[model samples]
Target: MRKSLLLFGFALALLSCNKEQAAGGKEFKTAYVDTYKLLEESEEMKDFTNKAKVKEGELSRELQQKAKELQLDAASFESEARVKGMQWAQLKQQELQKRQRDLGIMQETFREEFDKEFGVKRDTIVSQMRKFIKDYGKKNGYDYIYGTGEAATVLYAREGYDITKKLIKELNEKYKAQASKEEPAKKEEKN
Candidate 1:
C-alpha cells in the first residue's frame, strides 16, 4: 500500500509538469526552396552558364581545327609515301606516328585542363550558394530550410512556404555587387 501511494504521487507530479509544458509549446518555422528554380532564375548562374558555353564552343572549335589539320597532313604524307622509296616512306610513317601520338597527348591534356577548371568553378558556385542559404536561414529565424529540386525530395510545400524567389533575388544582388567590385580591379590589372 505504501509503494502504490508513492507511485501515484509521482504520476500526479509528472502530469502537472506535462500540463505546464503543453501551455508553452514551441512552433517550428520551416521553409523550402526549389533549388532548380533558384539556379535557373539566378542572374549569376545565367551569366556563368553563358560564359562557359562560349568558352566551350571556342575550345571545341580549336580542337576540331587542330584535328582536321592533323588529318590533312596525314593524308598528304600517305599520298607522298606511295611515290617516294620504301625507306623514305618508312621514315615519313614514323614521323606521322609521332605526330599522331603528340596530338593525342595534347587533346587529352586539354580535356583534363578544361574539366578541372570547369569543375572547380562549378563547385565554388555551389559552395557559395549553400553558405548563403544557411546564413539566410539563420538571419530569418528559420528552424529548418529545405531544398527541393526536380528529384522531388519534398513532395509538397505550400506556396507561402516557398522562399525560392526571395533567396534568388538576394543571391543575384550579392553577385552583381561582387561582380561590379571585381570589374574595376580587373581593368586596373589589365592596365
Candidate 2:
C-alpha cells in the first residue's frame, strides 16, 4: 500500500511539472543561412573544381581529336563512293550523315563522363555541407533558414539576422579538412 501511494504521488508530481513547463514553453526563433556562398568558400569545392578544370583541356582535346577522325573518315567515304558510281555521291552523303550522327553520340558520351566525374567528386562535400547547415540551425535555435543565391526568392531579410559569413567560414573550414583527408591533387603541382 505504501509503494502504490508513493508511485501515485510521483505520477502527480510529474504531471504538475509538465503543466508548469508548458507555461514556460520555449519559443523557437526564425533566422536564415546562405548555402551559395558556403559552397563557394568550401575547400573540398575548390579541390573538386580545380581537378575538373585541370582535366578540361585534356577532355576538350580528346573530343576535338574524335571529331577530326570522324571528319576524315567521312571525307574518305565521300571520295570512295564518288569513284564507284554517279549515284555514289548520294551514298557519300549518307556516309556524311552517319559521321555527323556518330560525332553527336561521341560528344554526348564525353559530356556525360565529365558530368559524372564532377558529381562523384562533389557529392560528399554537398552532403557534409547539408548536415553542417542543419546542425548549425538547430544549435542557433533558428526556426527558419534560407539562401541568398542568384535566384533567391526570399528577399528583404533583416541585415542583423544574416548568418551568411559565419556559415561560409565554417563550411570552408570543414570543406578544407575533408579535402585534406582525401589528399586531392594539388592544383599547382602536376606529376
Candidate 3:
C-alpha cells in the first residue's frame, strides 16, 4: 500500500508540471516583409532613383562639354605652336597642361560631390523606412517583423505572414501626402 501511494504521488506531480508548462507557453504573432519589393515599389525610392539619374546625366554632360572645349583648345594650340617660336610654344604647352589639370580636378570634385549627396540621401531614406516599419509593427501589434530579400534575414515564412503589399501601399500613401505638403512650401519659396 505504501509503494502504490508513492507512485501515485509522483504521477500527480508530473501531471501538474505538464499543465503549468502548457499554460506558460504562448504563441507570438510574427510577419515578414520583402525588402526588395518594398524598395522597388515605393514611391519615394522611385523618385530618388529618377532624380539621381537626372543629376548624373547633368554632371556627365558638363564633363563632356569641358572635354570638348579642351580638345578644341589643344587643336588651336597645336596650330599656333607650329607657326610660333619655341619659347611661345613652351609657354602655351604649360598653359595647356594647367587647364588639363584643372579639368581633372573638376571631374574628381563633381564625382565626390555626387557620391556624398546620394549617399546621405540613401541613408536618410533607409532610416526613414526602418522607423516606419518599427512604428507599423507597434501600431499593428506585431511581436516581430522580419525582412526578406537579397540580404534576406527571414528565409522561410508562410505566405500569409508576408506583409510586403500592405506595407508598400501605406508607404506610398505617406510619401504622396508628404510630397503634396512639400509642393506648397516649394511654391512659396519660388514666390
Which candidate leads in lDDT?
A: 3
Q: lDDT per residue, candidate 3, 1-191, as tens digits?
A: 97667656654653454344223474455666778899899999999999999999999999999999989988998788889978999998898899999999999999999999998998899789878887887777665566756553543334556899999999999999999999999999999
Residue 186, candidate 2: C-alpha displacement in angstroms: 68
Candidate 2, 75-166: lDDT as tens digits: 68756776787687786777678878877888888789988888876887877876676677667655445544543332223345578999
**What is the alpha-carbon lDDT for the whole of candidate 1?**
0.74
On a 0 to 1 TM-score scale, where does candidate 1 land against the true structure? 0.62
Question: Model 3 scores what on Cα lDDT?
Answer: 0.79
Clashing pairs in 1: none
Ranking by lDDT: 3, 1, 2
Give Cα-based local distance difference scores for all models: 0.74, 0.68, 0.79
| lDDT for 86 (candidate 3) | 84
- Model 1 over residues 1-191: C-alpha lDDT tens digits? 97667656654653454345222485555566778888888888888888888888988888888789878988898778888878988998898788788878887887888788887887788678877887887777765565656443432333555799999999999999999999999999999
Higher-scoring candidate on lDDT, 1 or 2: 1
